[model samples]
Target chain A: MPVFDQGYRRFEGTLRPRHALGALVWTAVRPRLRWWLWLLAAILSFYPGLVYAAITFITLAVGPDAFGGRNRLPEASGAFVAFSDNGDPSQLVAELLAPTTAGIVARLWRISEQCALAGFVLPAVACAGVIATDRATGAHQIYFARPVTRMRYLLSRIAAVTVFCSVATVLPPLLVWLETAALHDDPWFAAQTWSAPFAIALSGAVYAYFVSGVVLALSSTLRRPLVVGLATIFSYLFLQVVSAMIVHGLEDKRWRALDPQYALGGITAPLYGVALPDWLQTPWPWLVGLVVPTLLLAYVWSRLRAVEVAT
Target chain B: MTSTAPVVRVTALEKRFGAVRALRGLDAAFPRGAVGLLGPNGAGKSTLLKVLLGLLEPDRGDAEVLGLRVAADPMAVRRAVGYMPEVDAYVSGLTGAASVRLAGILCGLPGRAAQQRAHEILYYVGLGEARYRRVEEYSTGMRQRLRFAQALVHDPELIFLDEPTNGLDPDGRDEMLALVDDLARHHGKSIVLCSHLLHDVEAVCEHVVVLREGTVALSGSVDDVRKLERGTFHVRVSGDEARFRAAAEAAGMHFAAQDGETLVVRVPDGAGAREIFRAAHAAGCVVRRLATVEQSLEGVFLRAVEGAAEARA
Candidate 1:
């Protein structure tokens, strides 16, 4: 028999009080935050500043007469410059821009909602494969062999997607809302628009949870990230198309409740203190809207259970 | 080491998966140093490892590792133990260094500490040159070394190495075995090595746990397990065969000389054949050849498992 010797030394180092969730968060975000995302952030950060600049130019150059007759901003940019300033210049520009609390709330909702949707797409792609890739690569063995539970594992992933998506969804609208508030000379800006930030926050959070649940659940079933990302886009588009056809061709407004996009919009109306449309006032739309996503999330939980088996 | 209880103890452990009972009232103990877990397919080797790692729950009874109750604090049990599974795995999109570093970090090391340890362990496992390469691009041997590196990165107190030499050439297999030996002997890390290869177990392990039908059929030091009974031998001779047989019979030796000029004799262990030689020499017979027949580990293993089946039948 040969004497066995490989010179493996015992390490005398100490293990730190680890932050597992924090480490996972760093890994998920660091790789996806490329130059393209930075460029997007720069644009979002300055858009409100650009809006303030545009408002200043219009208010000073065209004077209050530009707001003389129109209750809304110019529908098209080309016609915006040539509209004759013939009406009497009696009202202030700010006064015509936001005449009441309802009017300003509606504008904030529309802007935040639009930014939220745009922000949702890129981050969704980033998070689409987080759970799926882990299972596909058998990396869960490395994780579960440590001191982590399944719940913590799932939460860290969800939190990662939420934080990533917020970069696009949550941050932009609040910055724009702040700039809009600061530009207003009206004293009612503070009193009337106080709920605007909170509403946008609530809307972004709901959007994050819903999207993360659906995308990650899909992720658990598949081994490929490409499939998961494509599925996410397809599911959203398919739901919209189905609901649109029913609402347009069949003349049945209740089917709109099943539309994820429409449901999200209606769900945010109460947060912004806007009333639901007459067609969406019934509970069927809300019921299917909430139930379908919940069922999808349940499917995710079940799929995660299967994915947890390391072998 | 014998006076104290084993480092791991499973008492009356029972685990059932659907209609299959993977473990049935199983009981075993493992002391420190290199121990081999031997069992045939579906004999509960995988399930036992998972239970000890706190990855699966048993139906009844309990297990203890490193003096901690596994049920009370499974995460703590896992924290102290390193595990190398049979599955081929890599962290997607990560280099070898990053994957090992993440394993350390997930096992509770700080990020910087984990990274430093990763560099050290990669070199230790002979993966230094391939540390920067993407894990998915690694060859079979390199990936095997990477798995070993990940298990060693945390410097765990005890490690479970499952099928460590599953798919390797002779040289690769020998190198892997030597590394395990060093961990057990030099570093003093307690090891539970699971493999289907009997020679691999015999080469390194001092203790053996032979599991059959979800229960331990044989458990002891390998030294005791491999001992032969009565030291049987075969001797070939020619001159004065009748006189030698009479003399051997009178000397109270059990001999059967009718198997074609060969006498099969039983003697005490390590005493050699002094009585037979003396009888043959006194009877004017010259001894031609004498050889000791030792029992093999395979015989012991087959009897252990097959014996269990016989008893069941």
Candidate 2:
């Protein structure tokens, strides 16, 4: 019951609109930074990259001799000891480079996709309680009580999840790609696989944006974080199952786009020069991958605006 | 902002939630200093607060906060006013400091400044030591203080406190009322205190506005509202009660109500203590206590509400 009768002191400092968004994003993400679930998700996200790095190191150590003969070994890789001394060393450089380079790029694409899948845990954890907890605690009313607009609040939530996703999904694969390039020590291999990191980054970003958008959109509609988290995870599995049943029942592969993850892979695989699996191949992935997230995000914006005004 | 000028003004404010009219052509001007907003359930006190904060747009009419039209520039109005909502609301996982800082930031304070003010305001509201604890851990009183801290963190020109003393014990309620009074009287902050507790409002507010059925039932300074009737006094006497009653009635005085050993009598205009003393002497009773009884806020509220109902009917 102590009284603060020093009288109120007016604040003369000016407000910065730019700081508002950053403050909101920071506050939204700060609590989860120390949570064990987020840490576990971060580790899982990098697990694929770690596995890919190990594979690249082993392949580089075994050298072109593992592919066939000494003649198949690139000259640039002669720094390593030869496994076979009796074989002719006159094979074309393309002969030594094509299969191994193709194999490495393919492996990187697979790992990138794996990283995206594992990184689902990041958005699941990051966005689970963001809007749901706010709604439950009535924090959204406090936010709307201030000068904050509905659009700014929605943007901050999406940005926080996107940032978490980038760190968890995009950074690890790029690091793995850098490690792959460094271990090979062959200029020809580096030249052929230079765009692998970009592809990994691009596909990882696409995955992050898509999953974060869908999960956050779900979070906006619910009031319990645990329910939102479970629902988000369930949605992926449900989409996969329902899409597979439809694809098989009608004997049409085009409907595979209904499975967001499959559609995402179809869209991202081309960046690594890999096509969708023969049976699942279709032209719908590009449309589905790009359109679904956009629609969900638009829905989230509308929902937030309604909640702000109605409540 | 002069003392006489209004901190908030609404004209022909009409709001409808489907078929139910929450506010029907409500008009009010809340002056500077402490003003009490008193209303019962579904009286539109909460609706008016929301509209002033720009959280909800009125279906029709003009509203202004700190002279800025809410509809034309709600952000500017929000920048200058702070609100302590009636409902319990706080960021679940955030510490008290973080919650207040977030509010300050949303109101447009720079990050560092918001952080600084968060600490100062929490300490001001007596939560200095508990600033680091998560809001979920706070008690009812502490959470109320936290809400006040967040509302004051930005130091806006006007503050809207809805049911500020809703669940506090006597001591806590006294402390809150003292703080509110100090803010209005000493610190020069305009306050709109909405509460069902008439005593709390009477203790802290200078001006009062009572709402009924989404419209203003009564609005004026507390003194003026209570001063509606004069020459009414509470008289206490120790003598034969039958003789005393006869004597008072004979003196053109009518008993409006009575308490144990005390009589509340309404004296006719131009009547004074002389008439009451004469009546008591004639009754062979000693005048023990005689004092004018100012109408309580409850009386004003009931009269206003019931009067409005009768007029409408």
Question: Each predicted model: what fraction of the native A–B Cα contacts (within 8 Å) does it retain?
Answer: 0.56, 0.70
lDDT by residue (tens digit), candidate 2, B105-158: 888888789899998888787788999999999989988889998889988879
Tell me the alpha-carbon RMSD of every candidate: 7.9, 7.6
Question: Which segments of model 2 are wrong by more than 4 Å?
Answer: A5-7, A61-107, A186-202, A270-283, B1-4, B229-294, B308-313
* i-RMSD values for every candidate model: 3.5, 2.1
Candidate 1 stretches with Cα past 4 Å from truth are A1-19, A31-96, A99-105, A115-120, A181-195, A284-291, A309-311, B1-4, B228-296, B308-313
lDDT of 2 by residue, A52-124 (tens): 5554454566665454754544353332111112333332233234446765676566566655556666778
Model 2, residue B60: C-alpha shift (Å) = 1.8
In the range B1-313, model 1's lDDT, one tens digit per residue, is 2435677899999999899988999999998888999988878898898888888889998999988789999888887888887778777778899989988888888778888889888877777778899998998777887888888888997888899888878888888888888788888788899988889888989998989878998888888877732455677766888788788767766552236877776554455588778888989988898876465455457656666667679
TM-score to true structure, per model: 0.79, 0.82
For model 1, state the Cα shift of residue B191 in Å.
0.7
**Which candidate number maximizes DockQ?**
2
